[model samples]
Target: MNRLPRLRGQLFERHEITVEKDIVRARQAVGRAMDGLGAKAIRKTRLVTAASEIFRNGLNYGGGAVALIHCDAGNRMVWVDCIDDGPGIEDMALALRDGYTSGTGLGRGLGGAKRLVDEFDIVSEPGVGTHVRLAGRA
Candidate 1:
């Protein structure tokens, strides 16, 4: 008879991981969550890709943020919430448009993040903070 491996549940927290050039670390963090949840390779890749971009935006433009990865038996989810007390987006509609980057161009911006994730939520206030939440199940 074959036996299934026992499942493990864990909650992880990463704080103050700068978002500017830490794309590699952000990818690693999301990859860990995907692997821990037993996500297939393809699914894991997609999730990590989307998450890496989101993390970068939060770090580079938004200033910085944190991540919360949660896993349980039979399912896994990653929650990335980036907060920055900087000049928040004055026009969210314009900000979410593709190819709208405050710095550079040539790639889809926040809109790409929204399209790539299973779930996405964002809120911001001028002179306060920008909060972006992205979640995916595997």
Candidate 2:
């Protein structure tokens, strides 16, 4: 017989990223979640930074977005999903590259966020929208 992992505690939080202030809220929410999971200071900071970058990208490039935060206590892991309904990236490769920005910023958002998390996934459709998933382990 195969054994599956036992389930423990789980957390779910959602935030709408429609404005500049929402990004700050999302970062705070992420920090709180990480702290609850007993994540170290550096881990919490990295996750919060990654969340902020993703939120900004979704708001600036995707026109707006929603963020869903999840925590699995048994696994000591947390992840966030940012979904946006706007003009999506035409070239994911170019978009993920460092210093590649369609806007005025330095263009380090996507790549930098990826480096901060343990897991990262991004999907986009040119005429549809984009979804970014970032995860970290405590």
Candidate 3:
């Protein structure tokens, strides 16, 4: 997985990752939650795509992780957090660049996700795991 950004906040919903099929549910849950919270359609679509990439990384490379999606209406924003527990990225810079994937992917996951969100943050440790948080304001 690429170097992911870290974010901290009280997440209202949490989903565990154990198998591949969970990715579909993960994507749906996040999209519905954001929609229920009044997030715009475009925001939901972008975030859904980003969430898919993040979940893919979490399972494929990071082994597994939990997905946290929150809608802060008081703050007029929606955010998603994914935490993985595999060997973290060693080169943060390379992971952020385009066409630099270490796995079989097209290397658009991290960079594309970043572009889709209004705010993006990633934090990882070599021995630990990775934390990625993305947000959008509607």
Candidate 4:
């Protein structure tokens, strides 16, 4: 399921920051997004690092997208989901490689994203979009 809980003090935040070459804004947006979802120092750092990459991908490559930050009460988890309706990845496997890029990309992409989180889920289609959901516990 792509749904997260709406618990109190949850502080879920959604944003559609512009992807106009301002990666700093993207990073801050992510940090602010996870301010109080029961995140600790290490976990929040990991999540923000992953989020910065995804946010940049959305802004730089995709035609921009939305970021979803929410709490998973059932699992005591904090999740971040970024969705973009940009030109879908042509080769999912290749794009996931540690150093794969089609220009305007840093090549870290999915590999780095996966390493930063406890759980990662990704789905993409050529003409559709990309949906990435990452989870980390408090």
Error of model 2, residue 73, in angstroms? 0.7
TM-score of each: 0.80, 0.91, 0.89, 0.80
Candidate 1: regions farther than 4 A off? 1-10, 19-21, 72-75
- Angstrom error at residue 126, model 2: 0.5
- Cα lDDT tens digits, model 3, 48-115, are 89988998899998999899887777776778888998898899889989998989889988998999
Model 4 per-residue lDDT tens digits across residues 16-103: 8475544565556556545555567788889788887777777777778777777656576777777888777888889889788988
The weakest ten consecutive residues by lDDT in model 1 span 1-10
Q: Relative to the true structure, how large is the alpha-carbon lDDT of every model?
A: 0.68, 0.86, 0.83, 0.72
Provide the clashing-pair count of each candidate structure: 1, 0, 5, 0
Candidate closer to the true structure by TM-score (higher is better), 1 or 3: 3
Sorted on lDDT, best first, the list reads: 2, 3, 4, 1
For model 2, where is the 10-residue window of minimal lDDT?
1-10
Best by TM-score: 2
Taking every candidate in turn, the Cα RMSD to the unseen true structure, in Å, is: 8.8, 5.6, 2.9, 3.7
Worst 10 residues of 4 by lDDT: 1-10
Q: After superposition, which runs of candidate 4 have C-alpha atoms over 4 Å from their true positions?
A: 1-11, 20-35
lDDT of 2 by residue, 1-138 (tens): 111222234646889999999999998988888988899999998988998999999999889999988888888888888889889889989998999999999989999999999988888888788888888887
**Better candidate number, 2 or 3, judged by lDDT:** 2
Judged by whole-model lDDT over C-alpha atoms, candidate 1 comes out at 0.68
